[model samples]
Target: MLLETGSVVAVEPDGLWVETIQRSTCGSCAAQKGCGQSLLAKLTGHTSYLWVSLAGRSADDYHIGDEIQLGVPEEVVANGSLFVYFLPLLTLLAATVAAHYGIGREGVTALAAIAGLLAGGALVRWRAYTTRHDSRLQPVLVDDRQVVQLVG
Candidate 1:
């Protein structure tokens, strides 16, 4: 479980809306000064919110501004990343190849590749919408009360 701490922003019937600051690894990376990601991170600074379901806990237990930890599965993140990046490129390449061999025209091939890319994007969106309510994809609340901190 990958843990992240967030503050409760809003209370929902079944869950709490938590706001987390997005932190980039650019500071630790060797390409910190050269990469466009570092620049992009600076432009898009922090504060992303997520709606986390409270498995069996009542909403009354938590108050607005309460801090809690959330855990997301490593496999889920890895699989999602691959699906988003690879699917589009795969479709683009497949379409280009099919067009090159079938129609044998440069302009038509380019258009087909574009269409394929669009299709891949639409598929990604559809998958996200379909899985919006999936329990496996949702992040689990990591209860901090269960932990026993040692004081010497």
Candidate 2:
């Protein structure tokens, strides 16, 4: 499980809205001072916050200021990343290859690749919507009593 700590910002009947700061890992590297990512991080700052809904617990169970730990399975994260990234690339490649053999036009082949990428993105969106309510894919309240700070 990948755990993150957040404070309860709002209380709903079925869940709690928790807010957490978005952190970047660029600070940990020895060459961070010379890295583009480090410079971008410094320029953008870490003021952005993410609000997530945690199910399976009611507002009455936790106070507004209570700190809690949220978690999602490692496999779920990996699978989600793969689905988001590789699907479009695979479709683009397949479409380009098919267009190359069928139409034999470079411009048409590029258009086909774009269309395939859009289709793949739509498919991923549909899959995400259908599985949005799945317990395994959703972030759960792992430890409500632990008040430790989250690290990137």
Candidate 3:
């Protein structure tokens, strides 16, 4: 199980609302100088992510402003992150390589590669966004006593 700490933002009769902060890798990236990728990321506000999850037990088990530990399975986190971060790049790489080798014309190969890259990137991003947006927190375990923390 994966564990994160979060504070209860809201408490309902049936469940508690927890906000989890999102982190970014841009600050750690070595190349940020006039880089299109970096600029795009900043423009899109991809630097941080916020999510909410349920305490998994009873809504009455927690209260507003209470800090609790939320648990998610490792596989779920891993798969979700990987699909978002890697799948599209992998698809583009595969496509570009396949096109380069399969086509004899340079113009065709370049166009195909660019098209594959854009399409693959879009597909991956859409999938990632959908998954993240639709994801609900399923509690593996909850600790009301623990302080609110973002575990991911």
Candidate 4:
């Protein structure tokens, strides 16, 4: 699980919006000394922030002025990333091979490539829908006590 520290930006009856601060990897990159990206990052500072609305969490215990943190499971992040990158590539390769065998014509190969791209995109979307439906409940909140402390 990944724990992030943030503060409540807005509170609804059951959910809250949190602004989480994140650190950049540019500072730690070996090319940072010479890279333009590194210079821009350094000038802008290494911190980044995002505000996300968290659903199904109890906002009663949290006041608007209170600080909060969140826990995101590793499995969720991994599965999402895998589908985003690997699934499309796999589908494209499969389609290309199938197309090559099904039609030897250049025009046919191009058609197949286009079809494959659409099919791969659709498959990824379907998978995402299936995942969300399979998980019946919304995300729950993590108390401050449950948060793990890490030393840099």
TM-score of 2: 0.71
| Residue 152 local lDDT, model 4 | 80
State model 4's lDDT: 0.64
In candidate 2, which residue ranges exceed 4 Å CA deviation? 22-58, 144-152
TM agreement with the true structure for every prediction: 0.78, 0.71, 0.55, 0.59
- Could you report the Cα RMSD, in angstroms, for every candidate shown? 6.5, 7.3, 7.6, 8.2
In model 1, state the lDDT of residue 58. Answer: 76
| Best model per lDDT | 1
Candidate 1, pairs of clashing residues:
none
- For model 4, residues 84-128, the per-residue Cα lDDT tens digits are 788777777788788889887878877787787788889989876
Model 4: residue 58 alpha-carbon error in angstroms: 4.4
Clashes by residue pair, model 4: none
Best by TM-score: 1
Q: How well does model 2 score by local distance difference test?
A: 0.74
Candidate no. 4 TM-score? 0.59
- The 10-residue segment with the lowest total lDDT in model 1: 143-152
lDDT of 2 by residue, 84-108 (tens): 9999888889999999999999999
Q: Total clashes, candidate 3? A: 5
lDDT of 4 at 52: 39
